[model samples]
Target: MTMTIAFAGTPTIDDAPGIDWREQAACRNHPEPNLWFPVGINDPCDDAKDICVNHCPVRETCGLVANRTRERHAVMAGFRCSDPDEFIDLRIWLGVENPARRTRTCRHCGVKFSTRHPRRRACPECRDLVPLEPVHRHIQHLRNVGKYTLRGIAAASGVSVGTVSLLAKGQSPYEGPYVSRAIAARLFAVTTEQEAKTA
Candidate 1:
């Protein structure tokens, strides 16, 4: 029996009658094949993706197949549709329903905006409004001059020992659920008082 893959706008049959469609994939020759299957959201895949998508001759076909099959993992045609909803959004942006239209609704503010990057969910306005990293020096001061241990800082300011450790080590103190401004202010006041007593 002959099998045909159907894309949203057009259908293309796999060339070798009985063979699987993936056998004809353009990314089959990649050096680090596992790089395509990134484990985390922040994992680096751009180098492999560039070869698989931009350099591949069958990128469009790959995208069509990926979208049709509702692929949840792996990059296809430079797009990583992590879920069915993301695939639908990709199709809409690809102009499956309307060829002339190419826009995506921002995940944050629900504003429609044009984007060449398929993975971009937020509009420029919302992207710019994202919070900047907190100043690490405030935490450093407590550790350096105030001589506060991680446990001591955690006890005094109610910030976690892990966060205090990161700050003391000159690492990202503001990553993830970090010390709040109120807690930081309290720590700053405590450090200032310590500084005054030692002076």
Candidate 2:
């Protein structure tokens, strides 16, 4: 696959006539491109994350580009290149640090679409139909009954701390009105007391 990644100086092949978000990328002109790719290993896990999470304004767009072009294991998005076969294997791919795009069928409408998120199983309109109250109730149970903090729940549930925070606030910032079924399953599966570390 020919990927025209508009990273700093690189020319993009699919200039679909919009503002170039790449210019705002924090990794622009970095000394080592592998600091982001690290296709050989998964060690660039920390500092790079700081750049994307703290500085990059176009982090979402960058991941979208990577997913759109199928950049073949490149860590254009926040996905860690830790596992050697991250490109070939999907099982090793985990939560929170999710980025990049892949094609998935919506479980609700049976519509196929491109998504950069691993948890997005339904289209936006159908996403609301997925019950989120159960997930929130479980989260509350974990917090109130189990005495776990939001961060603790985030760690155990494989969901982001920000997502957990939003859910507590009766908001779903990353998702529509609900989290994906996969995410819900993940939250429900966190019965381990230790995994749900106390704050």
Candidate 3:
């Protein structure tokens, strides 16, 4: 596997563009720098990958570094020198502190944000101006009416179960107008009636 990887066209430093290999090389050798990899190959969990991909800007470079070092365990850049028996025992491998904390960084705005709520992507500033799809709204209604699951709501609304889950989780941020109206007619009936009363 190592032989195959090494021969796979060193991917000229420039060929694999959009990432800084020189700077990363410097950081790799730097006396004090952040590490990227954190798991041993035989590690018992799968969640660390979330942190690696989330925080990594040049994830490919980090992976290459891990391979070059011939690390038997999954290592983030240099996040783990040796595999610890457990995650809590993990200490600073590179420069990152508290890898357990989930945070989001916008690629477009380069803004850093954190959230305690799940199913959220952009910060409030990015999300507030965006309109909600009607299909999503309908899914919410089914959930409120004791559906309690995406499959149940999808069955009732004739939408895909995956689509319903994405709507409920806020993962499907884009939708067509037809789906939007269907969602509104189903979920906002009570709210619309209340609006008519005030009107």
Candidate 4:
């Protein structure tokens, strides 16, 4: 029998201070234990946003927090989920206010990412994740090349400070399988050995 493995990707946890699952359950008249669990792509009905809209005294603040964090990934109140496609939709509808596009791809998985900062190596989801050896090699390249400063690398790569920081620090860059392979190859090809031998 060919068994398929499924892993949860999205961050649906409500870790905001002064807000708990119990409060959400009470607000929505749902069971406490059930609401506490993280919602996946399958559980579409878990309208946590509606709970925020109705129960949260700081409704606007809550929405702002959710929006700012880019955490709301599905029917958040009346607002659609904050998926990558949704962001694209929002950008099309409301206009991408931020000049920077903080999206990235993962070397391990083909999934895409939408972060506050651009990624240099791997996506946030892939950071520290035990996967392939090439990913490690890629991160090491960033460090050896004095790409430690996130903001500096971001400016240079046109990626993002967050991404550069993650890559330099040995963390995953983003989600989609879109590593800057061309750049990495070029950088790696010009090894220190060649430079020293030339001198």
Candidate 5:
């Protein structure tokens, strides 16, 4: 029996001698290389599997090698095939499977619906009710009266510096269509607190 082991930072097969099967493996140089390992009967890392299935150039070759060698316990060609039967199933799943479109429950309306995009968490009905303009106006007011920096507004409002910068420039978070209620509430609370302190 011949065991082939490749280490991180090792030169790819194209750059080195011999035709290492791992040369075109997408798991190479991955931060969590061990995500390739199977947890029970399923591939533990969906992201890693997606990379191997979609991006890996040598997926078929790697799968063939793993199947022939009866390699169990580790992910090969994006499949967590522990046995020959599982390998066949993995092949079938890879060919036929389509990822289910993700959906999010609206935080405000208690309604669930499919979103056109992943970042759109709120339902369309509640999108107009988010009340971001007042929060934007209050943030500007704080900056003008209290001389608050972007970092200061972020600290006070419990959001990221980038978010505060966006609001300061009349932009939305992540350039998204809606502002989260938590952000508006926090900004309002901070503004009220500042007003109380001054009064």
Candidate 6:
């Protein structure tokens, strides 16, 4: 995750000056704590987004803090942070990224991104998540040779459905061109049932 200087000028926890808002978090006592710290696709933690985005009363605060800290891990207020810009994007959406920062919707991901550069079209994360041909080949292999459904592959591989869909672009199971290096490695490592049986 790209690190960035944060908390430079933002509101922290509202309960107590600098106190964290974890206590009031809807996921405070969630059965699966690992949902927030999902590592790559091994534990997609898809439900974490719902909790952070919908159920949590402090979702706005959560997004603010995540942006303020430039956190790259976990689901913060429904935004999957893959880069410093995502956090900044959230801050920008909240109208607090920076005094001088202007917001633009990422052409690739469609998320509002904070930018001082006029030519920037996609968010930092979306820009870095360019698709790879090899990964697309693997997707084809999963569907054709392995007889694996996209959902099945996602559940088995611990990769998020969105990641798989992103790689697929829009043509069903493989069309677009945007998968991050981390996603590529995770997807490349996934094996079809045929290969598994042979092994």
Model 3, 1-199: lDDT tens digits are 1212221224453425675554444233433222233222223223434444564455456655544553444444433324432221222222222444458873222358875333344453433222355545655655675545766555555545654566676555342222233343433443333344686
The clash numbers for all candidates, in the given order, read: 0, 1, 15, 14, 0, 3
Q: How accurate is candidate 5 locally (lDDT)?
A: 0.62
Query: Mind giving the per-residue lDDT tens digits that candidate 1 earns over 1-199?
Result: 2212222223354434575556555566455665666654445567756776557776666676677776677666666565344465567645573434359986544569986554666565543321123436766666677776778877876555775566555554333423334445545555645667876
RMSD of 4: 14.7
Model 1 lDDT-worst window of ten: 1-10
Query: Per-residue alpha-carbon lDDT of model 4 for 60-147, expressed as tens digits?
Result: 4333433555644434323344454434333333334334656767554435876543323345443422332354465465456644
Better of 2 and 4 by lDDT: 2
Which one wins by lDDT: 3 or 5? Answer: 5
Return the TM-score for each candidate structure.
0.44, 0.36, 0.23, 0.24, 0.36, 0.44
Cα error of candidate 3 at position 37, Å: 48
Cα shift from native, residue 153, model 6 (Å): 23
lDDT of each: 0.57, 0.60, 0.42, 0.42, 0.62, 0.63
Task: Evaluate residue 48 in candidate 5 and report its C-alpha lDDT on the 0 to 100 scale.
Answer: 62
Worst 10 residues of 4 by lDDT: 1-10
Model 1 clash count equals: 0
By lDDT, the best candidate is 6
Question: Lowest lDDT 10-mer window, candidate 2?
Answer: 87-96
| Pairwise TM-score winner, candidates 3 and 5 | 5
Candidate 2, residue 30: the lDDT equals 64
